[model samples]
Target: MSGIPDNLVGLHKHVKQFREKNDETLFEELELFIEEEKVRRKLVLERPGELFFFYKEDYIVVTEELSKIPLTAEEFTGSSSLLRQLNEDQIDMVGQLTKELVILRSMRMWGSYLSC
Candidate 1:
């Protein structure tokens, strides 16, 4: 009842090779993390330092490493020491604080006009 070709002897060989050679647990964990990241980005406007995001007024600059900007998830995960410096949570907090600074700057600008 199987739909695979009867003559295909090596069809599953590659899969077995991959499973045997690769760290399946780590791969699965990374896969799940990727899925969660996708969902989080979909539900939210921003994803912290994952992207080149920042508030302009505070002169905040948030950008990923040049090498990682173009890499796929598989490539990023495979490479060691590629993204050791960037902290998503810390970057997100900095971005938020920058936005607040921008708001404060605009308020001061208008407040001066009202006072005059």
Candidate 2:
């Protein structure tokens, strides 16, 4: 039936190709981490530095907030070089952390207002 994810191909909703490189790719990846109603799964979020996220739910919230910003190599290249090799899952986790850092670093002057 609906077991295979690729089987969703017949649906009318727009399907995006990864090649175009747009918000859809980010949203699609974000959607994969969120579980609703009948389908629940574990989410794993990683720490790139001093930040700490105790629960998996943090990934859903963090990813949504982080996606609002775009990626830049000038900000990420240094920190990302911490690892020489990353498997797919590690790449995702590290990328998420890097994005989070970029946003927070960019918002640094906002100070305590970040909580608001």
Candidate 3:
């Protein structure tokens, strides 16, 4: 999915408004924006009346007729530890790929010398 939904386009405008209005109630203002997005999701998503719920079974379940309300903050929060680990892994892989490419190029050069 895209980074941000189209309905949230007004968020930028709101930010501008907040700046103009000198509103220090940042959390409350942002909460309103989040609620608006949630309502938008209800309108745009299928089975508008339904919601996903986590049960004692250690698995999440989605049911009809709004079994539970989902918390967007909890669901959307990123694990800093997980993200850092992933970035470290990616750096290691890129280093290995670079080393392999250098070795392959050197091997080709060595073979060319031997064939001369």
Candidate 4:
């Protein structure tokens, strides 16, 4: 009944082994894996320092006017040691703030044109 492929006998065996060793069901491990993946994906975009809009940006009319310039991870003001100290959620929040700052900077450059 599970979505795991029938052909993946090795995978099934591994799951069984893990279950027996840990006394945790395969479904429980799968759920934990999925949750961890979700957090990982949310914390870091496709590329380091990349900005992706997960939802519609209704608050800003010129939402589509994002800077095409790519930002490097090294460009972030946060030091690597300091960044390492933050949790996944905090890292995500930092990424969001970095994206917003870039957008705001771009808007300032074109504010006069949009005002008309």
lDDT of each: 0.38, 0.38, 0.39, 0.41
Q: For candidate 3, which ten residues in a row score worst on lDDT? A: 92-101
* Superior by TM-score: candidate 3 or candidate 4: 4
Ranking by TM-score: 4, 1, 3, 2
Give the least accurate 10-residue stretch of model 1, judged by summed lDDT.
52-61
lDDT of 4 by residue, 19-96 (tens): 454544655766765665565465555455544432212222122224332233454453444334333325433333
Against the true structure, candidate 2 has what lDDT? 0.38
TM-score of candidate 2 relative to the true fold? 0.20
> Which structure among the candidates has the greatest TM-score?
4
In terms of lDDT, which candidate is stronger, 1 or 2? 1
Estimate, for each residue in 92-116, the C-alpha lDDT of model 1 and write its tens digit. 2222332223344455333432221
Residue 8 miss distance in model 1 (angstroms): 33
TM-score per prediction, in order, is 0.22, 0.20, 0.21, 0.25
Our model 4 lands, by Cα RMSD against the true structure, at 15.6
Model 3 compared with the native: what TM-score?
A: 0.21
Candidate 1 global lDDT: 0.38
Q: Could you give me the TM-score of model 1 versus the true structure? A: 0.22
Order of quality (lDDT) = 4, 3, 1, 2
